[model samples]
Target chain A: MIGVFRQWLAGLPAYLWGGWGAIASLLLLLAGWEFASQWLDPLALPDPRTVLATLHGLLTEGEAWAELAITGRRALTGFALSLGVGSALGMLAGLSMTASMMARPWVTVLVGTPPIGWLVLAMLWFGASDGTPVFTVFVACFPPIFIGAMQGVRTLDGQLREMAQAFALPPLQRLFDLYLPHVLSYLFPAWITALGVSWKVVVMAELLATADGVGAALAVTRSQLDTAGTLAWIVAVVGALLAVEYLLLEPVKREVERWRTLA
Target chain B: MAHIGVTAPALELAGVGHAYGARTVLSGIDLHLPAGRIHALVGPSGCGKTTLLHLVAGLLPLQDGAIRNGFARSACMFQQPRLLPWKSALDNIALGLKARGVPRAARHAQARDQARRFGLDDTALGQYPQQLSGGMQSRVALARALVLAPDLLLLDEAFSALDVGLKAELYRQLLAEQARRPMAVLMITHDLMEAVRLAHAVWVMAPEPGRIATHFRFDDAPAQRSDAQVYARTAGLLDDATVRASFGLDAPAPAAPLALAAVGGLRC
Candidate 1:
């Protein structure tokens, strides 16, 4: 664990250095936003400066973190549930031809049904509770995680399996060493996608069902014609997502993938 | 070989036959490898040399006969490197030890020692298999097999895919390992001269039930044999009617050398 941590820390400088291009691109986006805001009514679209100021006010006032936490808890609870169930079921289904074949059209159906449709159904089933948003996030996020795990299992090289058997790997070693490492490459991308999906779907669910959370706050700002407040909430949500991705996940990904990735 | 006591057992096969449903790939095969001798099974592709090897290695179910593999432990190397792409070279070479439940630090230390002997540097051991060159991958694969210190080692044309230089280097490494470790080796290869240069006994297989057609023995030690002797012995083996029939290389006497050259082992 210390070795992997050291490797990640050693590679941190280059990883951060690569972020300059990202910052430049984001700054260009702010410039575009500033230009486009010149003609629009403030209610329709706020300028970037106004949005930043509003976001700063929300942070200093200290209420934004509570609402963000509520929404994060719902999204992440659902995302965690889907990540576990989807990865497990998908791998089990992939082990057999009949199971996978039966699962394909079902996966297609789940992926096809929009998150709004699921939210409506969840609201009907679970009322105005947290279940509505949590269930919606899970349903919206299941297909990609499931498919990633299934494909990972299905695409494992037969020669490696044979090699493992010939070497007589213990069951635990077979699981942790041989299977887990191979599947992780596929699972990480799917998990990231599902996490994004989870966030978006949970917000949509909360906007319609919940009386709290950042989504409810956005709904409040919408009613009051407060475009800057709405944009601030959006910025807060997006910033949180970016922080989770870059700060937490990307470092772990680099640590696991350093074998194939160049130093 | 079959008459030995259980104390120092060698690999022995008796009347072993294998059939995939109705298609028989091997039949009536009796073979033996003394504890520390090297044996090569030489045959053309589709002659079931692989199936026979698999049966001995317990990779395939035995259908018609029995194999008594009394070696304490064994490991195999395939035509491909077969290293897990996600693993570092040290981890790959340590696979068998890991399976045997050796602790991480001990296995890694042993793997590092073996990798260094195979000419892999410390940086190479830290890197993954895909990051290395093909020859380097092959070395890692060989190191993976040898780190087990098995009494028997199986090679399924493990060197046939390499260029001549790489093949020669691996051959040297194999001989050097054998000098210190003294294990029985059973390798399958289509290259008749590789068999002649490396094996104490070479068994040729013919298709359609894949029975052994000829057995050739070399009295000279493989490490001491010169390139010229290998070539001359290969030429002499090619002239045998059974060897020609097994390889489908029946040619007029004057054109025999040309036919033998085209039989695919003489390239630099």
Candidate 2:
């Protein structure tokens, strides 16, 4: 019987085993929260059970799904725009020292200015439309991606460049085959950071500038003094971020880096 | 082996020189490589041997002299294999043909055929450079160079890193390939014996604004030379005061002695 149980445990997916520690930590946090709720006002700090029930209720409602979809679209659109524009500009900077020097001040300014500042400007410029949230996300996420890609290109092996020249490979082939794959090692980490920022900025923008999406729903829950509902929306936002990271970003990163293990 | 008749001198260098900013690396170099011969450049480090190879291969611009290349195509094999880590051996070999505007299918087929000629089997051809052993990587690199069917082949200390057995096997492969075509080869090496074993003519170079110190031509075909003959020639060259001085052996030894080894002869 013990041997059969061991076999079943061993056969479990690695991620399931890996996540057990996180699961244990989460249970401990929930227990602490439950204890705190019993000691404090229920309205101020809802118990884990109450928050979970609120999340279940929100999941069943069609409005919650629509809001999630809207927020997801905004975040993704903004992230995509940032990736395209940032990588292009980053490559240009990487290729030319003069360009890198010119770009430094602009990158510093953008990075130094908080995401809230961009959110305020976006809300004023783009108004309470979908554009405001997307613009905010773009403004928040572009700098990291740009910096990562630039460093990647700058640090590419000089020997490989010499080899490419010796072979007289076409410019396009060199860019695609030699440069792109090498740059990806630097690019992937920045992309993950950008993705996280995109979700956060989009939600914040929605709460401040728009009348729809999870952030707007959270604002409504706050005004109504529904603490459980507010926590449920926070949980939903975090869940969406993790879902995109695991299902989209991580898989693509793993596929691209599969060659590394061989090396 | 089929010979493609090449009539003109494969490469001609006249008063070739190079400098970086204020520092001159090579100066007043003159050499001629006729078709269907292997020429070797022997020198200590910082003697501009690699710089001259680059100049001949057209990787470096002519700064102070004229280099006339009569060859239709030229290929270089560097000291390191320099194979794309991401690419399979077949793909790496096919890259040269692809650069010359060969179609994908034809280049791949040609690469596979060339791989077989280098004794790289189907399994090795399918593997990436990082997946292969050091010797296998070198074989793939040699295959990549020869697949171009270049009229002139430039090797910049290409076999210096390999063990003795692997080096000998590659030497035979290189000779056999040359026999199939009338390609002229220019190799750079620190080893005098290696130069003697592989080269029809060996040029000894001097350092500090590098220039050719001496040139020696051998009557014996490199692939056919016996161990005794190679050792005798090497011993004869080493005994000469001019050759020894050019190699910096006559002077008080520097902090680090130049590591030069004699690979006895071509066994294969």
Candidate 3:
């Protein structure tokens, strides 16, 4: 674990340097928003300054962190549950052709069902508690992770499997040394996608089925005609998602896949 | 341990037959490999030389007859390197030892030693398989098989992909390793000269119900044989009717007028 942390730490400078393009694109987006604000009514799309000021006010005085914390908890909880179950089941299913074949339509159903449709069912089932958002996030995030793991298993080279057998690798070595490393490549990308899905779905679920969260704050701002406040909530959630993805997950991914992406 | 000198543990296959559903690939196969000996199986493609090797390596199930593997441990190198792309070359070299539950530091030390002998430098050992050149990857694969000190080493066309110079260098390393440690080797190849140079015994296989057509044994140790001797022996073996038939080659035309042929000339 310490070695992993060291590698992650050693790799951080390059990783941060690679973020210049993303920072520039974000700057461009801010400029575009500022330009658009000159023509549109402030009621519809407030300029970047107004949004940033409102977001600052919410951070200092309003209960923004508490609501966001509640939403983050629900999103992460649901995402963790699905990550475990989906990856486990997907690997198991991938090992057998019959199982994966049978699982195809089920994955399709999960992926195809709109989160709004599930949110209504969740509202009916869990009422106004955290269950509605958490369950909805899980349902929304499961398919990508599952399919990623399944493909990872199925696409393993037959030659490598033969090599493993010829060398007499133990079951644990086969799992850790051979299987896990290969699966992580596919699993990591799907995890990022699933995390994005979980965040988006939880917020949507909160807006319709609950009375608190960034989504609820947005709803409150909408009712009060506070367009800047609504955008501020959006920026907070988006900014949080970007921070988690870039600062945390991306660094970990780079360290793990150093063997794959050597310069 | 069994009596030390009492019949040095050998692999004996008797009447081994294998079929994939309706199609039979191998039938009535018999072979032997005593300790510290090298046997090469030679034939055209699709001749089930690989199938027989896989059977000995326990990579495939036997459908008929019996194989008695007396070696305590064995390792295999395939036509391709087959190193784990995610693993550093050092880890790949240490894979067999790792599978045997040797501690990491010990295996890494041993692998590093063997890898250096195989012409891999420290940087190459630390790199992943994809990052290494083809020749370096092959060296790592060879080192991986040898690091375990296996009683039997299986090579399925392992060195066939290398350039002539690299092949000669590796052949020296392999023979030196074998001379020092005294382990058995079973290799597959299409090149007859390779068989003549490396193997103590060469078995030719014919496809379509694959079976051993004939076998020849050389008296001198492989390392002592000269290149001219290898060429002469390979040509001598190729002249045999059964060996030519196994390879699906037609008989030479009526003897032409004798002419003084230069060096490296076709025997035909």
Candidate 4:
């Protein structure tokens, strides 16, 4: 018990220093913005407290919650779809050269094209429904996960495979014992990056083509000249992203890495 | 010229030939591995000794000849342990059985049973390879190989990295375990003294597209030979003209000159 506490205490200074550094930088930026507003144009960049006040007012309104929920749902649904399809296809491609050759051109095209370009085409096909945003999110997220998984399986040690063969390990055991553990390390990072991009793309797609979401709210605020409201929605998006990263994905990543910790 | 009456041998490689691209690494190689005995394959580096071991383990397909096996299962210990860095020692040991279709509950029980025989404590089993000493990690690897109770075992310099005392200790442990259940072992090593101590029959191969140069059969019991005696016997075999030529050593003059030199017992 005492040892755990001592370890925690030793880590406290680093945590505190990081927190203070962020706060100090933010304060300096805000003070400069406020000083600039007094001397020159005020409409360019607002102070931090004004943005916080705008955030508080936005949180009290019912429409803001609805917008945030719509954006969140689209991101989750699209990310889940891409993750399932991408991982399965990636594994298949990794196992068979013919499959990889067939899929390589499409993977390259999908990853290379600008995501907004796809959103415009999706809007033309689906006519500005939730599908447009969801499809854009899928395109933005699939490539990284696919490539990571394929490379993970490809780069597995040949000696280990030979060892497995000599032992006559079944296919399932080969997957878990020799393959999956090696792949998971690469896969998790790709998944994390994919999820983050999916959220951002979903919002951008919603802003361009849809009538609902935080993106729509930002669009609405832009037309009305409600700059404070626009900043508040941006804050809300950032805060939610931070929450999901810390409370959900990071915990799962740590659990997957627990064996390493034991080492 | 040489015979051991090894009928019903555990493994037989008859006119085995393997080539990569245009270069033939092994050609017309014949070996008869007797059941429940240690056979050493000794040669200089790049003599295709490792390739032969891999062939016996069924990692490489027979290209031009036949390998008749008397055993169903074969276990291999690589030059390095080649352990899974992500897994604990016990998990690594259990991996062979898991691959062999053993159930999880039963595999852990069997792994624990084998680990205890290898002098591995529960804590040691729980730790990863990086956390264990080199000797301890090698022991775990040996346990992993032995746990499968393979009919044939192939080792590629399995103990060459250990200190002299530790290597001797591991040899004793391995022999004791083999005594409990007889296993046919084919090991490749550059250490002639080690080969002398452990091998019932040592087959020496020449370099550059390897072939069996000759063989030495130890007349003394493995338990009866001290390190010095083992070294001396192996040195005497190495003094043979063909063995010396393979290793790029200076060859003695002629049959009479070598016979006279042998009579004089000249030590270099």
lDDT of 4 by residue, B102-154 (tens): 88899999999999988899999998888888888888889899999876889
Candidate 2, A29-90: lDDT as tens digits: 87998999999898999988899888988889777799999999999999999999998789
Candidate 1, lDDT over the whole model? 0.88
Q: Which candidate do you rate higher for DockQ, 2 or 3? A: 3
Q: What is the DockQ of each candidate?
A: 0.50, 0.49, 0.69, 0.54
lDDT per residue (tens digit) for residues B105-180 in model 1 = 9999999999888889999998888889999999999999999998899999999999999999899988888889
lDDT of 1 by residue, A82-190 (tens): 9999999988887788999999999999999988999999999999999999999999889999999888888889999889989999888987887778788898999
**lDDT assessment of candidate 4:** 0.80
> Model 4's DockQ?
0.54
Best by DockQ: 3
Q: What overall lDDT, based on C-alpha atoms, would model 2 receive against the true structure?
A: 0.85
Write candidate 3's Cα lDDT for B142-219 as tens digits.
Answer: 999999998899999998989998899889988999999889999999999998899988888999989999888775
Which residue pairs in model 2 clash with each other? none
Give Cα-based local distance difference scores for all models: 0.88, 0.85, 0.89, 0.80
Q: Provide the DockQ value for model 2.
A: 0.49
Candidate 3 ranges beyond 4 A from true positions:
B1-7, B252-268
Error of 1 at A162 (Å): 1.7
Q: Chain B vs. true chain B: TM-score for each candidate?
A: 0.93, 0.90, 0.92, 0.88
What class would a CAPRI assessor give candidate 1's docking? medium
TM-score of 1: 0.91
TM-score of candidate 2 restricted to chain B?
0.90
| Docking category of candidate 3 | medium
